[model samples]
Target: MLSSSMRHTRPRQRLINPFARATARPGAASSSHPCPMAGRGAATAAAAWRPVSVLDDWVAREARPISLRQLMVFGRSLTESRLISSANYVRTELPSRIAHRLRDMQQLPYVVVTNPHINDVYNLYYKAFDTFRKIKEVKTLEDNDRLCEIISENLKGHLTVIPKLAMGILECRGLMNPQDLDKFMNTILRSRISRRVIAEQHLSLTETYHSPHFSPGAKLSESDFIGEVFIRCQARDVIDRCARAVTALARSTNGPDAQVPAVHVDGHLSASFPYILSHLEYIIGELLRNSVQAVIDRQAKLREKAVAAAAAGSTTSTTLNAALNQPPPPIEVTICEAQEHVIIRISDRGGGIPRDELPYLWSFSKGPKSANRLENLGQVPRMAATMQELHIDELARADLKAPSYPTPPPPTPSPLQQPPSAATPHTPSQQNSLSSLTSRPPNLRLGMGLPLSRVYAEYWAGSLHVHSLEGYGVDAFLQISRLGNKNEQLTTRASMDAV
Candidate 1:
């Protein structure tokens, strides 16, 4: 059992948002007491630019009035607050290079951070936060419904920006000191914990708010208490959509009508309870894509051998063509539910991730092997979007609180874009893990898939892990916690001290 202190979650109605963070701009008004390390934070705070406010034009559409700017400020302010704090996160544990990077982040003027990806993430956050802050006013079902609409809109916006944000962060990774990698990793971990908390709170609140039978300040029914998450995820339907996405992607890469091996689930498709669908779609899509690619490559090789045999007079031409046309083995998906968790296993026979690459399966850094390619993380998402084309708008639809966000753009090759040859191609399981569903082939792969997926998987009380059999295949296990009311965020030092 967790301590009472651990169970303390930020109030859902109106979060105690720091006024200073209400705008991504640091010079904004103050709310919460000053930081404990005010002496250390003063310069960074002073140098921080005031957060920008969007032009608010209240427009009523479909009987719902949307305060575009307030929502925008809400999400961005939350992000800015976290990031501003993260800029100095675990200062004592970091070395100078990373520490400097963290502090420098606080000092970055809004104008200097010109990337659309960076800007969009903050924008979405501010919007979401603004909506979240208004939950207390949801005494009536109509108000709750309005709140849901705004929240969904912000989530859609999140899809448009997250990959870009991840890419932007990685662009400067090379400047990180080797010895301080752990420290940098810690910073990301904290950020992930914060994101998870924010997702669960708002998403769960959405479930309650959108329900026709829902009531404010009433005891939540046990049956409906998964808190708006991990509920009624149609595994069969999800598989169908993902399979279509995979097939379409495969055909486009190999041929307009190329017959890639289909994905085969080991059991009857089941509906999952309390799971985020978009994130699942991404995970499953990536696994199937790689599996299909491997089967296709294997079939091609078999055809090559058969053709050579035919020339050698050992096999008939007709038999060789028949052998060449046989469908590759289907990738198997296994879904199992326990009392407290939902587990999905995706198995593929793509000649398993190369043995040497196994250890780094979870890493995002461009190690020594691809040093000569000279591409940074910012370009990987664009490349992945270009080749495999996993971006789909349907995934952003708000059913179970709009899972994660939308995917990267379609795979469009351009002279400006560089393929992920800088590093070894990641597998299907990892390909769609966090970026685009596109993974490795003749040369393409989702460059940031595995690490990103891990973030999502671990965001809740869940896990994503890989088990590989070299020269045979790989199985990725994704676990989603079925329990509810987890700690919304990590504990702060101040909280711990009080405890």
Candidate 2:
């Protein structure tokens, strides 16, 4: 059917198997037909089914940039037409972003690309990109409705992206340098954040548009929420909620008698701004959990030393009793509302981070040298599926549940009934048994906590900093921009491999 010139033209690289296989020759199935030649043809067909280069067409397409301020303005008075426009924007933007990541993966060294975890992630991204790029134009409410369904399904399908990416990087750590790995990870995570921001923003707007209470033309007040962005978000309220949730979690995991420290929140108690509540919860919750755990561990060490001294006859009963009864120092949180930002300081008196671990504190490519990091990495697939799933309330939904502790035995009826000394308080057996390295509870340690928190904070033009006092404690500073006018920082690096 082809013209002479067309038939003689050089063939384009067959990237993606778009066409079905050619049918076997007539009577090829009979005994007379050569089986080895047919098998060879099929093998060649399978080997040539490459699809990596096809993503370039989509990657060449540009993504429409979006900002938080724009989100708030558009969501303030969402209408049906606006909702449809948002849906289309998300549909087109997501594919471009997905394609970009796919290209980044394709450009990796063949060895790294072939890693099982990375290959699985590549397939998922390709599937999502293919499905999204196939959607028809949205011109009606019905069309938008179908697009929403598709978006939801895709979002659900990509839930394991974070863990899969982490595992892949860990496996390929030796194949790439630290700087290159960090850049690749930052690009992927930031791009993901941008995509989710638009996708979720549109979904929320659609929900608000259909709500009975929504009045498109009604004048809105500063107290109202425009989709997921709150016009006046209470900073302290979210911190308190996350603190309470973390406190409850600590007790349940450490045992009934665990000495969880109190978080003392002060300054600018009523400061409010336009922000996303879920984001605030995650950042604050992670920081607080780290602080509380540090304080608890510090106190436990002091108690153990006191008990050891008492056994060795090194101190008087008064001093020993004081040490035994001492509670964990309170964690202090100060909130400051500036003209254009909200700055929070979380100060804790837990023994500071080990000096050796400080350099890699915020580096995801190389975690601190500890067995706990590896254990936590192993649980990522079961522990975390999505950012929202990191919230305290969602902890129960994870498959790796915390172990239960038996009730502590009642005080000894008589001194003889107990061992040589009855004065020592019941040792925190459950807490001590759950070593950071061997514990089964995934919440206790996620190796990527500090790094992920930093990414989330920086995603919106904000920042997170940590200062450790070596043997004293740690102070964390979090800056949030209330203006929300900065564009997202997404990288467009083609390849990170060294020449």
Best by lDDT: 2
Candidate 2 positional error at 455, Å? 0.7
Q: What lDDT, from 0 to 1, does candidate 1 have?
A: 0.43
Task: Identify the runs in model 1 with alpha carbons over 4 angstroms from their true place.
Answer: 1-161, 168-170, 177-230, 234-236, 267-271, 305-319, 367-444, 484-499
**TM-score of each model, paired residue for residue:** 0.53, 0.79
Q: Which residue runs does candidate 2 get wrong by more than 4 Å? A: 1-50, 369-371, 382-444, 494-499
lDDT, residue 471, model 1: 74
Query: What is the total number of backbone clashes in candidate 2?
Result: 1
- What lDDT is reached at residue 147 by model 1? 46
Compared with the true structure, what per-residue lDDT tens digits does model 1 show for residues 1-499? 1223322322121212222442454543222322122322333333332332211111100111112122222322232233223222211112221222222222232222322343344444444434443344334445434544554444334444435545433443443432233233333443433443333334434443333444433442212223223234556666665676666556656875566776777554564554444455556666666677877776777778998999899998789879877777778888887887778888877667777767666655444333322243333443322223444333222122212222123331221111111111211212232343333342345345565566656655568888888777778888766543233223232221221
lDDT of 2 by residue, 1-499 (tens): 1123322222232232221222423222233421122443333333433465566677777677766788878866667778888888888888889987776665554445545566667777878888888998889988987887777666656656776677767656666776777777777877877776677666666655665555765545566555556567677866775676567667766765888899899999988877655566667878998999888889989988988998899988899999988888998999999999999999999999988788888766675553466556666553222233433332333233211211123442211111101111222211111111122352546577787888878888899999999889999999998787766656653332221
Task: Note the clash tally of each candidate.
Answer: 22, 1
lDDT of each: 0.43, 0.64
